[model samples]
Target: MTKPGAVSSAQLSRRSLLRRSALFGGAALLGPAVLSACGDDDAGATAAAASGTKVSTVFSWVKNVEWAGFWVGDDQGYYTDEGIAPDWIGGGPNAPENVQVLEAGKAGIGLASDTLKIIDAAAQGADFVMFAATLQESPVGFAWLDPNIKSIHDLVGKTLGGDSSSPSMIDACFKVNGIANDYNFIQIGADPAPLANGQVDAILCYTTNQVSVLEAQGLTVFSATLTEFGVPLYADALIAKRSFLDANHEAVVRFLRATIKGHEKNIQDPELGARLATEKYGVDLALDYDGQLTENRKQIELWVSDVTRKKGVLWMDKDYIAGPVYEGIRAAGRTELPDVNKLVDLSFLTEAYDGKTTLLSA
Candidate 1:
């Protein structure tokens, strides 16, 4: 029987195109009418000025509840209020990497999925800086249909399905649980069909995403979140190239101000954010409204935490950033870590809120 949070590769692969379409569809959103007319010699400079200082942000993933705040900000004209025209670029398999997009001057800021990627980029001489983390904890986890598999320790000899990124998380789980590496890993995409069909014992995926898909399929799923398993990784950080930040500090601050406000609004009414994302910005992406709503609520749970409760959403303290967050990356086999001081600049977030902490509600 298909368990809750279990999906076949066929189901996920089919929906995968919907996500990719949003990435490619971003071009349609950035047509001439939206972008300001400019000469080739100073395209970036003129584009920034033409539309009241255009600021393009490339997301790490396609449009979904993960970007509910950006959609809410756009719909509510928060970006306009900040005196900037924001272009939100979606990411997918076919989309260029977030750092590459930023390096090419396509985006002023990018939403990166993990600190590892940022660290790697910095090591490779990319002048990128993480200004804020949207998700306090990562949603990466292992989802299993078998009741026997209640924890990461239970999957000693079971087949774990996931993509290239899955192994590091699995290794982290073993290390955290003080268990040996005995689990067999099968290369799989985001699809949980293999697991559902008994092809694989379990699948590694985002708890906020595949969990809802499996539950919708009426399966009983048990998920082991990596965060609880000894890998407390942060997800979805706001990043920008150093050059971009240096030239447009005010624009960055303004952009974050509107984005945080949007997140605040989304926290108040997730259904509204979901509706706006699916019916408006993601209208052409063929999104499932009910599913998106479920994901939106789950995503909010990841965004707010004890830290965010005290300092507001997207807040990160130096101790946590340099400690557990960095250690998680190291556990994943990354050795050349970026300097914490050079990697994160909290001044933008500080400036956005005027040094005052806004408590998260709900």
Candidate 2:
């Protein structure tokens, strides 16, 4: 998922259009490497025929614990074992949207914030299909430094700060608990400073990102995730164009296999993943090592759940896609929900693990 200040979808779409034009114009002058025709599949074939294929993946945000698997996989030569040289693209406020980049053929695979975005993009004829879910549950939640606001029920009469869209999830939670809406929703950015300074009782932010920052600033922050309150939404999924998946089936499988192995390694030893992300992949980001380590551990906890514990990391359970994920989208007022079959393709993940759930032993 994107950090607080990341650009919006509209902004990303415009930037991508410009980038596509520039790339196409440069292709005639620079040759095939600058052309979209040299997609991941062709790259893989070239790798087989020559050295190794280099594939690029556009992440949703800047390098941090959220991308531990990719970093660890690259560091451990997991992608190399698959005959794939990975180009890890860092994203932030200026990076184009993942789906836009994939559709433009700038990147082979991309990570999106949620399936809903992919569904919406597909409706607009993007042809993006999700292959693996990175985080089982979204980390979006309401956080506060006040100890009295322990649960969702306690925020009934308080003022909460967040984007206007955040109310959909909050409303879904209130509906599930049969509680009447009494709290005042104030529109704000993804900053917890207002809550820290007593401007708002709580603020909606990603638990994995902001909670640690709040705690480190000398506040006892308490949080309640949307999933805990009956919104079972998945976050951060790997997606590629349908045409790309159709052409590079084996390449996709190999990529996911290496990726899953990387996640397993992260689960087994989060410190290693943290070190790789901070000291290696994210060296230029000036990330805090201790803060990143804390977030990495929290992210690993989110990656596993009752479903993943048995079905393996990145497992796309049909029941989940059809049930809670669907309901959460509807609750959020998104009506153009794509068909579950069209939205996700789990064949690669299933083949990666041979249809067996694999979990790291504690």
Candidate 3:
């Protein structure tokens, strides 16, 4: 007989949902014919334009919601106003990884999942520097079929899904709640469908994505949250090369500033956001545009609050990062943590909310 706490197959179902946003990046909404932009312009140039120099932004995997804010900025001419003319490129399995591109000078901004990667990158002698965090609450959660599997204790012996990036949070949630880490965790590369297929019991997911996509399929996913249980981590940071920051410091700052406003819009407007997401921004709408858009908007709501605003829109809690984050990652068996200060650059966020940019009403 199955234990009372153990989730049953009946609990997880074909018509279930999971948490939304997580590791997977977004895709562009519309193709070039459907949407158009001034491709080459020195819009983000802070000091001087290098005679028609064009910079490229490598967004992760087509278009996920992580890059929506920047897309909003571009669509609204925010980047043009900032003197930066950027061609936002789609990233995927074939696209260069952020660290590599930044190192090779391929892309200007590097977007990725989890701050843990930040420490690893810096330690590897990678030139990436974290600018701002996209996910305020790390976007880590488990999606099960059964509401009975609400608590961590309920996850025992149940099959979970995710990559190494989120296992710590998953394990932390289980550990803090007194659940065993011995539960089934299938190694899912990037797709959340396996969970929908009922191949695994539940899977780690992001609130702005998998859940929404699954739900859109008329499947009901029971999203289990790590923060609600016990553990927490940072997700989706806006990163850039150290040299890029140094060379185009003002531009980078402006980019961040514009992004905040863009995120603000990204949250407020879903259709326009989704339409723009498809047309300009590269968010993978693959049969789930509304779902993806809905989730992205939800993320904006969960995080973009005054609590995060330190005189402006900043996604960092200083004491928490300096204290909990460091200790937490170390406890997770990471070699070391990145300097909390280095991981967070509040200057741009400060300046934007503090009225630094005179152009876009920042």
Q: Write the per-residue lDDT of candidate 2 for residues 291-362, one digit (tens) a residue.
A: 777788877778887778777898767778788777865665567777778878988888888756762332
- lDDT agreement with native, every candidate: 0.68, 0.65, 0.56
261 in model 3: Cα distance from truth in Å?
2.7
Which one wins on TM-score? Answer: 1
Worst 10 residues of 1 by lDDT: 26-35
**Each model's TM-score, in the order given?**
0.83, 0.78, 0.76
Model 2 ranges off by over 4 Å: 1-50, 120-126, 150-159, 163-190, 331-336, 355-362
15-113 in candidate 1: lDDT tens per residue?
543343232221110100011122122211212443666767676665556788877877777778888766666665565666666666666777777
Tens-digit lDDT track for model 3 on 1-362? 11122222332333233223222232211111000122222222222232223546655555655566766766776666666555565555455555565555656676655555666666666656666676667655776665566566777888877764556667656655555687877776456767767688887766456666565555656675555555555566677766676777666666666566776666567566666655444333332455556656666765653446534344566667777666555555566556667656666556555654223344
Candidate 3: regions farther than 4 A off? 1-53, 123-127, 164-169, 172-180, 280-289, 354-362
What's the best-to-worst order under lDDT? 1, 2, 3
Output the TM-score of candidate 1. Answer: 0.83
